[model samples]
Target: MIKKTIAFKLTSGFVVIVLIAMLTIGLFFIQMFRQYTFNSKEQVLLERARSISELISENQQSSGQMQRYGGLMKALGTLAEAKVWLTDDKGNPAVISGMGMGRGMGLGNTFSSEPLPAEAQKVITNVLSGQESISRNFSSVYNEATLTVGVPIRESDQKVIGAVLLHAPVTGITETLDKATNMLAISLLAALMLATGLGIFYSLLFTRPLKAMNRTAIEMTRGNYATRTGIKSEDELGQLGSSLDQLASKLGFTIDQLFQEKGKISDIIASISEGIVAFDLELVPLSVNGALSEIMNQPQLYSNEALKKDFEDLGIYGLLEGIIKDKKSLQIFKDWKGKKLKFTLSPIIDNQNEVTGSVALVQDISESERLEQLRRDFVANVSHEFRTPLTVIKGSLEALMDGTIDQAQDVERYHQRMLSETKSLERLVGDLLELSRLQSGKISIHKEEIHLPSLLSDVIKSLQTLADKKEIEIVYQGLSDAPALIADYDRLRQLFVIFLDNAVKYSPSSTVITVEATLIKGNTFEVKIQDQGYGIPGEELPYVWDRFYKSDKSRQSKGTGLGLAIAKHLVQLHKGQVSLTSELGKGTAVMVHLPWILGN
Candidate 1:
């Protein structure tokens, strides 16, 4: 800004000085010429007066002497365009004539400006007294300027008889001077105009490059170092442009390095399955990545919002507003898109220890939360599963130690209780083994055709007693002659039985627990188990197929939490899919798909 101001000042000053100098020189010459014109006019009048005096003397002693003299005076006055007057020594007029001849043609007629100023009058009077011609200039009543010359009419003895004075209005001579001055003014004005134009043109040439350099500097602040003043002049402006280009080049490289570093850090962060959010002091988004956008369930949430106005339109503006007002940040536990995320918001502080803005780190803790809950559930399930068996085994072993039973019939009760405990332990171990096998590819399923409708009916019959006790009705519908699926029959059975048993266990007495088997499009079989029971909540649907996850409301039941997990795993092992759709208090429809190859 300062440089621009200075440049403008210099340009204006240069123009002003050139104009002033030219105008001064112009006026100086014009005035000088005006004076020179007056002097030239004086010399011409004196020479004309001298010629008239000699003409009058040469024509003396003629018959028309006075007439000849009058004609000579009248002609001279006509040629000079002046009023001429002749007088005797005592100031009486002798011969008088003037231009514009005719009406006032007498010696008494005064058509002239006589009576000059003291200085010019004294010079004319002195010459006339010496019987010689003299010239002088003065102001006139005919517009304040008149030139006059007086010549004496002398005898042979050199005695003055009369004086001949040639008088003319100096305005005609002033006109020539005026014309010269006007010409000079025009020249001076032209010079000034040309100088101003040149100054403007050169200033533009100089300023254009500087403006581009300024733009480049401004762009650098926006992290755009690639901006340049693309000019190549031979002047100082060119040198400045070259310097600016060099600066831009160095800064561009630095910016590129910074970007690469930032990008590397960003890539590392985005590669994680967690979301990271950064904001500026204005509580607006500064940076966000793929994970954050995914977490937010919107691709546009993290894009291009760099001010508080951004949040105003978001409706969740209160969150940022509250944080800024409180000068604090906190981790918010959220369930986003059926996924658990631990969001930690931390304030970014300057060196002054003042919080400017906040940054959020979002972690997809769906798996972590699942694992934590798994650990808790495992501890509970293991304790419950072992407690019943351990109680029976303890009672039987105490009785045996006390010698309560000796014969086969008496000792058999203790042996059966020990066997039951041992079998329960075996079931627990077997479930673990199954899960490990599914995860590690240790157990490969042998695929075969299985009648799902028939198999499911048999399992229902076996669990009919348990369903009856819970007042749950097992209703098998849509069990048409569906195409038998080519899958691991044992694994399919496990998947079906788990869902069916859960439906029956949770339903009220006489409430229908529907078992549906039908052939879907494209040779696919959908086995749906729906229960008019207390349904799993929406929040638990994602976790239902996960390991060791049991709904809070269902924890009263005596069963391993691994049942659903194992079932889901087993179904997946057959290249099938299992999904649960339910709303709170509404019946759940657990759909398991078994694909059938076209030939099969």
Candidate 2:
């Protein structure tokens, strides 16, 4: 197999074209030169033939003396080396030259008295009709390649009376044409050889830069971006090379920028808390980041291949299908791994306003959902708490106005009931105000070192009456001279009172509500409140610190629902940590760790 380069192919094509052109022009010139030689011979014969016919027509007054031109014809034929004949207007040959008749080379064997042959007759007829005729191929009457010409003879009155026919062999013309053809062949060969050499040189000149550009293209395919075709010619090829260089440069820069932007987008997708994914219309995953994997509960799915499978497994395909069909965005919330995740599916629209794909954005909204629910519950609880007190006060006032209790004892009972309800309403309002200030960071604390033993003793003593009302014991267990803790004294007292009151209210009669304070790890003090009561379920324990939350709402306790919430917020405001652990059908424990800061 021959390997063909651009130079080889171009040169080969140019040579073939040159050969064809030279052959055509050479054929044309050779034919023209041959015809030119034949025509020159025919002209001389025709001129001598005309002179002989004119002499005969002048010498004789009629056809009776037509033989007088035979001598003249012989002389003219000898000089022109051709056969001459004289024919009357009726195409009858009357005289023939002795030059070729005796040699058996005339129009026929009967010479002067014979009829002209068909082809020569046509020439004679044309000549008699006042026209000249010449033919290059008149071989039938001659033994050699020949030219034949016929000219008319006119009388003194300008009327045609006879015709002269000339028949000449073209052998000398053939010899001359052969010599001229050989010379043309030699010139054509030399021209072809020169053209071939020039074709090769010019083909290389044109293809050299193209070859360089081709090599540069190969280099670019192999990732060598800096290669360039340094051709500087002002031709079209040079302009093409310049365009290619600019294209390569632009492509390299654009590709680098795309890689950088891709990295940045990947990092952003990975770092964000939301799960982000993009897919084409075919449901094939275009991109799937780590967050999306985590959201799908398939954290191992980090590649597009696995993510596509995950999408089907997680039923996200249906969501995407819906989004595409509707050409609109959709949002849904689901519980995933104990988190409330809100997923938004939006259609990816192209410039033509067609939905080409979709993107999913998943966010963890459990905290927000819980807060929103808590706000609703707080509003309802506030309304309920207010209604209870107001209802009792309105009943008592209506009883007094209708004179339904006119006796002194009945009147006093109604008055006391109204006053009790008003006090409860005032307590609820006060608790709400205090809780709001503590949670909103509007309340400030004045910190001082307070002995834990003394603080606990005072709290137990203050809540002992309430504990007794339920027949529950408030037991304190701690060192009498334990280390002091840095905290607001009044807030700390209030915190303990809320805890002790709750313990006493929730515990069974005759059960123990134990309070213990101890120093855990130096510079940190802990307080534990434990009670033997119907404990909260594990599922509801997480929300027990939320405002207006109650584990046993069925119990008709008179205290407001803000105790534990207020306690938790007040603890946090003092830079303390609070946690509670409980088990159903068992007991509950609350632990508070406050930093032990020494102060004035």
Candidate 3:
């Protein structure tokens, strides 16, 4: 029932008011008509009675003829359209005239001089006592309601004698009143119906705009702010609808701008390679991205407390806390999960320049840290390599200058040692320069399709004398029908020479060094140089390609520890990969893989 709207309620109330007004007016009119009808009947009855009384009085003065008066009374009753009754001084009836008794022509004796009814008796008594009376009373003679009027009968001497009365039925007045009441009832019904129809029409006209606004409000709640009310009128409801439409349009535009700004912020955060986290003044976590999860080593560190604890455990919270307290930026390096991480924390300031929150950005610096350490090690290694040969040359020269070697044989030995040291120094300087040139991309390759078998044979023959000095044999395998490689001829030959020399340098006496060349999957060619020598430790295998790194430092006298490193760079310059596998007391194998179909 409450769902019934204002329009329905208003219309129903209007109909009720119309009905009540119609009923009230109908009742008032009916009452007034009834009264008027009664008054008119009484006036007619009184007029007829006055005429009868005058006629009877005239007859009494002219002659002592009661019978003649009764005859005249009957004629007056007929003219008045009423029943007439005449009585003597003793209250005895003399004449009665009306329908059923007599046709107003003669007296009817059958109307037995009956005593009048109590109401009429009272009226006659008052008349005899010299008072005129008019009353509505029931008549026994006529058997209906009648208006009774009695006047005193007097002689010329002004002495009261008998009274004459008249009786008139009031049924006509009641019938007339009833007819008027029915017509009023019908007219009232028509008016009420008309009023109901008009009430409904006005109610709908007024409430249509309100209904549209209600629907628009509901749609706005569902986030469709573009909806509008189409009501176009000059009333208050129309103005309100226009206001609602404006509100929806404004809200839609504002919310759209907010969403676009939010999208841009999210995109910027997602695009960065570092871990970013924002916190409120209370250090509560607001948002975290995928990079932050990886940096912290905790994929579920979305909450502020969890992230804070993680950073604290990694020994980085003190830096963050200092930034928050001091409202300044801070940078710190921390170790987390065996990886070096650099964190930059800065305070976020509001428009008033007051610190409202803070943001932290984390980046992995492990690779960069390792590179810095390598730089330090490279300086030390270079100094050591150059100093060893320079110290030998300087000490030998001092001995000669101080005349410490006086014998001829000792002098020749010292001279050869100096030349050997000079050669070692020259080779070291040359290797360092070559490695630098390769790493800096200053050296370019001249590509040509050369047969692998011919290249390996030339490299082996060039280093055959060195292998023979150690009593180790150099053998080549899988060289028959070998695929041709696209590479710079001088660099490719140098690449093979370095590996074969290393195998010969490290191998035991009477052990065979095998250089295997073959084609592998993915259209790639591989060369494995296996040496039956003291194998490298597993931990040292990963660093073999690093500059100045050597598996057997005790053999530093043979060559600078840059041969394999140089080889690794040269292979990479040819778009190839080099890997080493070794075990203690077993043989070590170095494999180089080069794409067989280069620039195809």
Models 1 onward score TM values of: 0.48, 0.75, 0.58
Error of 1 at 149 (Å): 49
Best by TM-score: 2
The TM-score, computed over Cα atoms with residue i paired to residue i, of candidate 2 is 0.75
Q: Which window of 10 residues has the lowest lDDT sum in candidate 3?
A: 102-111
Model 3 TM-score is 0.58
lDDT of candidate 3 at residue 21, scale 0 to 100: 85
RMSD of 2: 5.7
* Model 1 CA deviation exceeding 4 Å by range: 1-240, 250-345, 350-374, 439-442, 450-484, 499-514, 530-561, 579-590
Instruction: Estimate the overall C-alpha local distance difference test score of candidate 3.
Output: 0.80
Candidate 1 per-residue C-alpha lDDT over 1-600 given as tens digits, one digit per residue, 9 for 90 to 100: 754564676678778888788778877877787678778877888788777766665554233234345556667778867777765555555566742332221234433433533434554576567645444445546653676677776666677655667777666656666677778778777877787788777777777787888898899888787788888887888988899889989988987899999889988987977777677777567777677677656645466543234334433356756676677877666665788767676777779978777777777788888788878977876687778778888888998898877888879867977997788778877887888788887888877777778888888897888887877778888865656667776777777778888887666677888888888785778888888887887767877866556675555565557788888878778778888888667678888887776334
Candidate 2 colliding pairs:
none
Worst 10-residue lDDT window for candidate 1 reads 99-108
- Predict model 1's lDDT versus the native: 0.72
On the 0 to 100 scale, the lDDT of residue 95 in model 2 is: 71
Candidate 3 per-residue C-alpha lDDT over 381-495 given as tens digits, one digit per residue, 9 for 90 to 100: 8898888878988999999999998999999999999999899889998999999999999999998888888988999999989898988888889958755678898998999
Look at candidate 2 and tell me the lDDT of residue 523: 79
Sort the candidates on lDDT, descending order: 2, 3, 1
Query: Which pairs clash inside model 1?
Result: 140-144, 471-508, 471-509, 471-510
> Per-residue CA lDDT of candidate 2, range 170-232, in tens?
875656667877877787788778878988899889988998899989988987778899989
